[model samples]
Target: MFDGFTPEHLALLRGAGVPAAWPRGGVLMRQGEPADRAVLIETGVVKIVSESANGYVSLLALRGVHDLIGEFGCLDDTVRSASVVAMRPVHGFVIAAPRFCALMEENGPLALAILRSVINRLRHADDQRAALGSSTAVVRVAQVLLELSERHGTPAPRWAPKARHLKLTQQELASAAGTSRESVVRTLRELHQRELVETARGAIVVLDPEGLEWWEPEGD
Candidate 1:
């Protein structure tokens, strides 16, 4: 992420890039395509997705403001590893691969920050893979919710009730959790019955974040 960037560093990047926008559901980058540029998200969220030979799609991660997309390709000179789609209307800066590489070479601090971010993401991916393999479906769901909240949630005002609204469809949640839609539906029903979450047309409202985070299957 570029949250740690100083004003000068930000200015350098902005000067080298062009601003772009995408409506919700628009594809920003396609898997296996030439990664000629990288996007630095300034607003809204995007989902990283990958498709298999069988045409099954899997959601890898949710990225929000300040996150860099398609940088892996630029770093390694490879095609895009996954597709990125806008989860909401998005505004960002698009920097050509060559320009981005040049910026890193010209700025030591910016390069170091990018390296740290890459390492952190690799570590987080490893942890998530392990969790998916070892944890129950409910636990995985809870973990995903916690991650979404930490990454994209907007905290309610101090005077307002403590609730967080996440704009994600059940199918998207299922893909992120690495489970089936039926499994996600069952888990949501349980959470709804417990008054921990409320589901609307295409969103989820967390009424008790603590309870959701600590939830475990009965008899566990």
Candidate 2:
């Protein structure tokens, strides 16, 4: 979905006649690869992630329809700075970078909205970095839960989901949160004993949101 798509913008997309479907996984785009094209989603989700020299991966963004990826590299005349992978099957409308720039130049209103969306995402990433680096693991996990809740949370007017749709394993969670599985498991157990979380077969659910955030221990 568009973070800032308007009815007028939808009209513009239709008028421009962008394609209705584009899909790829695995190596959707590679680091240092030329920015040959930019894509806008029409369906499904894609992840923008970067691999470090040590082979650690950091998730950058999750994009749905109307969220543009690789546009920055294309605009800056540089190679792609990161890789994009399809989390699931994706359908997108793709255009060469030069053409997208030309279209944006001609279509001022839609261009402005897209630019704003990109800027907002960068700002959010910066804030997330700050929070994760300075906060405790409990705080970090709490934030992740809130994020998953927003994107994959149920829509039944419930306080939160009984289970999250995070497609990450415990090791992955530990890496992202800068902690260990034992510690994470311990924290989960502590929360569980207090009836603040419920464990399913492979997933965990947050019961008392504030309690999870309040779980910071000494020297943690």
Which candidate ranks first by TM-score, i.e. highest? Answer: 1
Clashes of each: 0, 1
Candidate 2 global CA lDDT score: 0.65
Query: TM-score for all predictions?
Result: 0.91, 0.75
Q: Where does model 2 exceed 4 Å of error?
A: 1-3, 11-25, 153-164, 175-183, 190-220
Candidate 2, residues 67-110, lDDT tens digits: the string is 66777877788888888887656776666777777878998987
Model 1 Cα lDDT, one tens digit per residue, 1-220:
3345566766777787899999999999999999899898889999899999999888888999878888889878899879999989999999999999998998898888878788888888898899788988877887797678667766654312667777888888899988888988888898888777788788777777887887776667
lDDT of each: 0.83, 0.65
The CA lDDT at 169 in model 2 is 46
Candidate number of the best lDDT: 1
lDDT of 1: 0.83
